[model samples]
Target: MRRPDPVSRALTQVGELFALALDTLRAIPKRPFPAKDLLEQFWFVTSVSWIPAMLVAIPFGAVIALQLGTLTVQVGAQSFTGAASVLAVVQQAAPIVTTLVIAGAGGAAICADLGARTIRDEIDAMKVIGISPVQALVVPRVLACVFSAVLLNGLVSVVGVLGGYFFNVIVQGGTPGAYLASFTALAQFSDLVVGEVKALIFGFLAGVVAAYRGLGTKPGPKGVGDSVNQSVVVTFLLLFFVNFVATTLYLQLVPGKAA
Candidate 1:
């Protein structure tokens, strides 16, 4: 028999991933919720991701502030530097950083763990005993990612803003009052709402993609490693695409704060 074409294979995998996401979501509202698993997974994800997310956020925020500060000075709009830098961090960088950390750290671990189980036949054993691997395993990990992402998004935002503030004020000699005032002048509360929303959606996507790849592991240690890599790459692409779409919609639908 002829093998499927590349496009067809890709489409088939996409369909399988979608089906797995649906199955996991359906299992979420069922009885015997995996509270214990959820707690443990949440702790694991948070522990692995928090420090890295903060460390990354500091540099990310500093770079944004420095670039924007220089540009604002040249344009004679220096007072808006804080608003622009902080908004950029809160709206874009925070969620992306949070998702990246979760995917690279927590998501990889989830994929590898599940893939190992698949190789060992533990997943099959659960199914034979009438246990849904989705509920018993996937759901907890997914929800853990969601919770971790949301919480880490907030943490990154705060850390990023502080980093930006420090660079702008101390290094660039920007006035503290003007910097703080500019944020209130140009930033709407909706900006923050959209950022958190992005974190929530990104988290869910990361979890689903990781879990899907994990469950589809090809039955070897090498396959487990490949699945983990694929999960991270796929999640990164999906997160960026979804972030663009969501940002576009928000810009078109929501009015900006009057400066």
Candidate 2:
């Protein structure tokens, strides 16, 4: 059966979020960004996932070195493993992984919490009381996502690099410093720039998508479940597709190509 258009109401909430983000930005007449909230959000995201990330990252880093070793040796390019691993982890994996982690854990949690409030008419009650749910509910989260993504990406970069180093040098007896040094020699200023820029954007995306899904929640358990599932799937896909677009645009405008 076709579902009713419960989503129509959500458009308003989504618009409000964009406005909040924009208004916050515009209020800063001198600066181009909102650093404090962004930083706070980033720290929250990073701190919240520290334990899980540490647990997973160590094994992931170890396995990557072990797996790449066989392939690198075949081409007699064992030395390039560090550089290749670093680039792959930093440029490719980190942002996407952070998004997934947030979506699966933080995003889902937000959606459910908000959706529960929505089902119980708490959101409607807010509207009745002249409360700006956008400010009260959405702003913190949107800001959190933006900052969290940045923070997590930074954390990811550090862990990824160090993990690759330990695995290569200690575990596999490979030249570990190659990966750390690769950023200096192989990567451009633009590469790091775009990666971080994309991280901020991705964070907003995760928040916006999550909030949209959450606010549209209907008065039922099924609706909440659907919202959470959809939020994660949509968000993860959006991150990758958006990442691709950003990379393409960067190469077209910037001095160097990503390839």
Candidate 3:
């Protein structure tokens, strides 16, 4: 049999991944849902990810405040720094930052776990026992990833806002009151809702990609590592594309005044 070309193979792989995701989604409401496993994976994904997420968020928030605050100062609209920085974090930076952590850290962990199991034939063993691996493993993990991402998005948003506040107030010499006061001037409830929705969608996609790469890994230890790496790379690519589309749609749907 002739091997499929690279493009064809890639398309086929994507189709398989999509199908797997659909199957997992269907498995979600099936009776005998794995609550314990879902909770454990949820905690594990969130707990293992928060420190890195915070580390990333602080610099991200600080940089935005530093740049936007400086720009606003030049224009003599310095008091608007809070509104700009807060909106930046709430509408864009937080979800992307949290997703970077999820795709890099959480995706790697899930891929490694599933890859190891595949290399050990554990997945096959479950299949031989008449168990549906998607029901048993993928559903819990996908849900856990989505849940963890939403939670982490909230965490990142808080940390990012705090970082922006400190940098703008102390380093940039903006008044604390100015920073605090301007936050409500431009921000809206819809911005937070959009950010969380982005987080949820990103998390679900990352989990599906990771699980697909993990379970479909080739034989051997090297294959497992390769799968983990591919999972991260693919997830990142998908995320940036998704982020662009989501942000554009969000801006269109809920127009906000520039601060």
Candidate 4:
């Protein structure tokens, strides 16, 4: 039989991952949920990724303040600088930062761990013992990714806002009261919700892609390396595409009018 084309093979792999994700989701309602596994993975994900996420966020926030603060100051609308900073960071930067950490750090870690297990026959050993690898391994990691993304998004928001405030007020010599006062003037609760939602979905997709690639890895060091590379690349592509679609729908549906 003729070998399938690369596009055909790629489509098939995507469909397989989707089916696996659906199966994992279906298993969620079945008791007893793996609380212990979830917590352990959560701690692992957060401990590994938090610092990097914060580091990226602070610089981004500062840059935004530096650019926007300068522009707004020239127009005599310095107070609105804080609001713009809040809107931009919370609505876009924070979520993207969280996703970068998830796709780069967290997803790579997951892929490496599972790829090691795959090449070592641990997965097959679990299957021999009648344990489902999806339940025993993938589910907990997925939960951890989602949980960690939300947690990191919150940290990013705080760091980004504080970084913007510090840069705008301290470095740029803006009035403290004006910076703090107008911070929430144009932001809405919907922005926070949407940001969190973006983080959640990005994390879930990252975890799923990593797990799928890791599980399908062949028995070699090169295979594991390829899986890790593919995991990061695919997760990033999915993230950007999803971000566009999600942001568009969110803006259309909520519009997030300030109170």
Candidate 4 yields a Cα-based lDDT of 0.89
Clashing pairs in 3: none
Model 2 vs. true fold: TM: 0.77
lDDT (C-alpha) at residue 8 in model 2: 62
The TM-scores of all predictions, comma-separated, are 0.98, 0.77, 0.95, 0.93
Candidates ranked by TM-score, best first?
A: 1, 3, 4, 2
Candidate 3 stretches greater than 4 Å from native: 257-259
List, residue by residue over 1-259, the lDDT tens digit for candidate 3: 9999999999999899999999998989997899999999998888889999999999999999999998998899988899989989987899888887987887899999999999899999999998989999988988989999999999999999999999988898899988887887778899899999999999999999999999999999899999999999999899989999999988787778555
Off by over 4 Å in 2: 1-47, 63-68, 177-183, 255-259
Q: Candidate 4, which ten residues in sequence have the lowest lDDT sum?
A: 250-259
Among the numbered candidates, top lDDT falls to 1
Q: Which ten residues in a row have the lowest lDDT in candidate 2?
A: 24-33
Clash number by candidate, in order: 0, 2, 0, 0
Candidate 4: segments with Cα more than 4 A from true spot: 74-76
Candidate 2 residue-wise lDDT, 1-117, digit = tens: 764476864576557656655754444343334456446655665666656655556566666666776689789977667666766666766677766777777777777877888
Predicted structure 2: lDDT:
0.71
lDDT, candidate 1, 35-149, per-residue tens:
9999999999999999999999999999999999999999999889989999999999999999999999999999999999999999999999999999999999999999999
CA lDDT, every model vs. true structure? 0.96, 0.71, 0.91, 0.89
Clashing pairs in 4: none
